[model samples]
Target: MRPLLVVGGRELAARLRDGTALLVAVVAPIVLATLFGFALGGDDDPPLTATIGIVDDDGGQFPASVQREALQTEELRDVLTFAQYPDEAAAQAAVDSGAAGAAILFPAGFSDSVGEGNGGSVNVIESDESPLAGVVARSMVDRISSLVEARTYAVRASLEAGVPGDQVQEFVEANGAAGPSLTLADDPVSGGQVDLAMYYGSGMAAMFAFFVVGASARSLLVERRLGTLSRIRAAPIPGWTPVVGKMMVGFGLALVSMCATWLSSVLIFGITWGDPLGVFTLILGHAFAATMIIMLLASRAQTDSQADGYTLAVAFVFAFLGGSIVPVYNLPDFLQSLSLITPNGWISAGLTELAAGAGIGTVVVPALVLFGIGSVAGVLAALRLRKGLLS
Candidate 1:
């Protein structure tokens, strides 16, 4: 045990003195988290608003009613402001000049065509600068058109059912003026909010923790090349002592990287990762998993270059599959399920729960699973290293 501790201490000190290790483990993750957090808009961003131009060529009841209905809708009014234009040309100009995000042109004789039971066509002009606004405008036009069609069908059916022709107009007006029967309202499940900063910060930390441990594990090959392992073998140390020492170094480095990233995120981005105890438990489980997985990969490689390649491949694959590059909720269903098997995924999920104001007990199951994965990998790595060293 003393020999293992000494070996681990020596390796850790060497890693600390190396500038590359410090840069990869501590500096790069923080910088990337900051850039990503800023690039993606935060919760404080103002709500989207756009102006829509309306060209009333028909100047008739249907077009007037459509405009009146859209303007009166409270939900649409919040995000959409209306501007009246004299003609299609002026509306197009408004869109081109960025004065309007989109335009709806009611063609001449539009009301006459609809009154004759022939559907009228409405032309829409959109601006390239405001695509989201254009989508909203398009949806609005489609909704109004559907409502008019429904009213026409209702009036036709009432007339066939022996209702007076004068009463058909009343029925159309009553139904057209009515609002939707059902509307959706948002009800969030989580008690707390997770902004872009907290999300990406946790993702970057989980992804980089693998690199931190990988570097330490790869150092075994470096020491072997330098005849350091041979010199150590000549001493009274056991064969497994060096392997345990290397594992210790990798595990220690992983923990340091995770903690540093957490601190940096809090200081720079003002991110609050809820429940300090939960965060620490997640970090411990994730660090252990990263260290053992990298140790297993390094133990299989014949050379330092091969180990480096393995480390890069495994780290990136795990990161991508584990929601480091994209949110798990946004991933395809198959990929979301696949993430459950990765240590990175477990850590990301734990962090997300924590950010949502879940207690430390919420992360216990994930932490246990991570520890289980690490234990299996650690056993395999130990066995493989023991065989190689004895041989």
Candidate 2:
């Protein structure tokens, strides 16, 4: 038992001294996760309302009519929050200065043009920061403009076809909100939105945590190359001491690295991870699963290069399958079920739920799944080690 402890300590010290473990565990995750957060639409802030600046220079009722009708539209009501402006320049300034997320400018002749049976256009000025919301607002303007155009067309046809004045008046009244009736509302599904910061932060942390293999496998394969493995095998040190030591080294580093990564995300980025105790438990299970899987892979490899190849291949496949690259909720049902078998998926899902403001208790199932995977793999790896397969 003392010999096993000595072996574990030596493995740990050697890994820390070389610096590879630190780089892979700490620096790589932070950098890559920032890239992911940026790619997924920088800043994890979900939009509240389509705060828009309106420049209605139409000098007629159309602009007011559009706003009036927009208020009655339930879908638009969910998103539209307005600030009116007298001109395009002021409206654009509001958009640029962040006073408004988007801006709409109706030209002076807009109503007149529509009234004359000519379609009119409005300029939608939006910041690049809120591209999705800007586009949605622009579509809203297009819809309102179409409704106005349809009303105008009906009036024009009535006059041209020699319809009586009373009948033409009736025509205008009946077609006011006509043309196309549509609704656009975001699905209010709870936890439907994935916060980019948490998504990538948790993903990169779990994905790189598996690099514990690079160090652990080195301890095993290096001993074999130097014939230390056979010497230890024949000595009173016991056949399994060296293997246990190396596995301990990998498991300890992985758990520590994952915990550190998760903590750093909260402290440095001001990211919120709910329920500290629950998060710790889940992270521990994820690390355990990662270590066991890596151990098994290391057991099958003959040389350092083969071990490295196996690590990279397994890591990438696990990352892809486990929701490291995409949210599992966004995946098809079959894929989501398959991902449950991977540690990456479990950790990712747990983090995503926490990010949505659920307490840590919500993640118990995933953590338990991870623990089960680790236990099964750990058993299989132990059997292989007993058969002297790591050589």
What are the per-residue Cα lDDT tens digits for candidate 2 across 78-189? Answer: 6667799988888888888888878878888887676555667787887865543464556567776676678678778877998775576466666563555434422111
**Candidate 2 residue 93 C-alpha distance from true site, Å:** 30
RMSD of 1: 7.7
Say which candidate scores most in TM-score. 1
For candidate 1, write residues 275-306 as lDDT tens digits: 99899999999989888999899889988888
Candidate 1 yields a Cα-based lDDT of: 0.77
Kindly provide the TM-score of model 2 when superposed on the true structure, using C-alpha atoms: 0.63
| Reference-based TM-score of each model | 0.65, 0.63
Best by lDDT: 1
Off by over 4 Å in 1: 41-192
For each predicted model, how many residue pairs clash, with residues at least 3 apart or on different chains? 0, 0
